[model samples]
Target: MEARPRVAGIVLAAGKSTRMGRPKQLLPFRGRTVLECVVDNALASRLHRVVVVLGHEAEAVMPLLGHRCVTTVVNPLYGEGQSSSLKAGLGAMTEETDAALFLLGDQPLVTADTINLLIAAFADFPSPIVIPTFEGHRGNPVLFSRETFPRIEALSGDRGARGLFREYGDDIRSIDVRTPAILFDLDTEEDYLRLLREFPAV
Candidate 1:
């Protein structure tokens, strides 16, 4: 039998959360912390492995993820920006991984189904890059084939894989998904309140 391609899930949680006043990943949502929710969803997905890149408040956030089906990696240069965290997470992926799904830790609303859908889409196309789009807008938790890892590793500043997507736009396979969860992220006080009011029961 042919081997199934391995796909890894990467949760980027190393940000400083400067605008949110405190660590957004540690914020309580429904009974669990935001980072916990994100990690749980990633673990529940079909990805072969899940990795979380930690920084800023690693001490507090590290314990919360204890013994989950995920691996934790620290971004020593996290202060550099999101790209640094991306590099850290991708670097920790297992050698068998043929692709990787990159997720932001603050996007607690992103569900396992959404992630699974992206993985399924990648399995079908096996493209260099796969991005989820809702309506006409493109959003994260993007999946990239191992073919693009070299470019991804070379990313600098805060440009992120988005820059690589632009550079290799022709190779990007855009999958349209009907999920508003792609638009949710906890960046400000208003965003937190909106999440609380909208998903009070979680």
Candidate 2:
């Protein structure tokens, strides 16, 4: 088989986090803010590039990111919804990148190894979409092939790539990962506190 093209790591950090009251991406987690942890983890992965879509206090988050070997894309239309940020990030991808590993900023527990596993699965079996499922529940940081880029770019409203996956079910491939971290995301202050208390710092 031909060598699979490289993939970009797209981290969506443009949500308002209304439930958390503050930008959940900037919330402290294990000493570092949530967005920092997510970006650091993505940088550690073997992705072609790491793109962060920032908005909803983009200035604050941008400074925290500093000079990392990652590309930052600001989503001015972030207020529109998550789909806007997703499209912006995907738009920044290079043609060399055949796919993208989409991650959420609030998912601080998702490890680089989990991301690598997903990428490896995609390389072995090229699919339009590669999703990770634990037990019976499916979760985020989904992998999307370039084939679905058009549909993803055309997405609107509050819905995300999930809608695209459902629309193209025949092209979706799933891997049964045993890790539950895929399902863990810090959406509120209580959620963050619970995660800190349960997992602690490494």
Candidate 3:
């Protein structure tokens, strides 16, 4: 039998957070910075590698990951948008990586179980894109197969991987996640407050 493809975790944290008026990744959450919490969850999962993409307030956020085991990559053109960070993260991955799970840094609610479950689904039914869905709603930390990496790298602006869904919708595999955290991300004060109120455990 062939060796199983290696799955890596990519955390997109380079956003400027203009709406939040501050770096949301540095915001306090469960004894650690918001970005740290997200990275930690990915660490606790089954990914073979983890990389955090930084831009905007990279100076401030990079310090928080000082003791982290994940590789940190800086996107010089982050102001151009999320695609820059996505490309930076994917570029930093080792050649052995077969697929990558893209997670939002502002979304600290994602659990390790969800990541492992996504990996499990990918193992059973590998596809170009694997998104988590809750109650018919799609969510992130989206997994992209190696075959689709070239197109994703060619992506420009803030579009991220949305365009891929349109092109590869039929080939996309959806894994049903039980938690709403997959869709919850902190952007403004209200979103952060609501996240805390809705998920008290965090």
What's the TM-score of each model vs. the native? 0.96, 0.96, 0.96
lDDT value, residue 146 of candidate 1: 93
Over 4 Å off, model 3: none
Candidate 3 lDDT, 94-199, residue by residue in tens: 8899899999999888989999999988888888899999999999889999999999999999898878999996899998989998988888999988867776
Check candidate 2 and list the clashing pairs: none
Between candidates 1 and 2, which one is better according to lDDT? Answer: 2
- State residue 46's C-alpha deviation in candidate 3, in Å: 0.3
Could you give candidate 2's per-residue lDDT for residues 1-202 as a string of tens digits? 6875698999999999999988899888789998899999999988889999998999989988878988999999999998999899988988788999999999988888989889999999889999999997899789999988999988898889898866887778888887898999988789988988998888
- Tens digits of per-residue lDDT, candidate 1, 1-202, equal 6567788999999999999999999999878999999999888888888999999999999999887878999888999877898889888977788998999999988889999888888888788999888997898889989988888898898778888867887888888889878878988999999999988863
Task: Give lDDT: candidate 2, residue 79.
Answer: 94
User: For model 2, how many clashes?
Assistant: 0
RMSD of each: 1.1, 1.2, 1.2
Clashing pairs in 1: none
Cα misplacement distance, residue 2 of candidate 1 (Å): 3.2
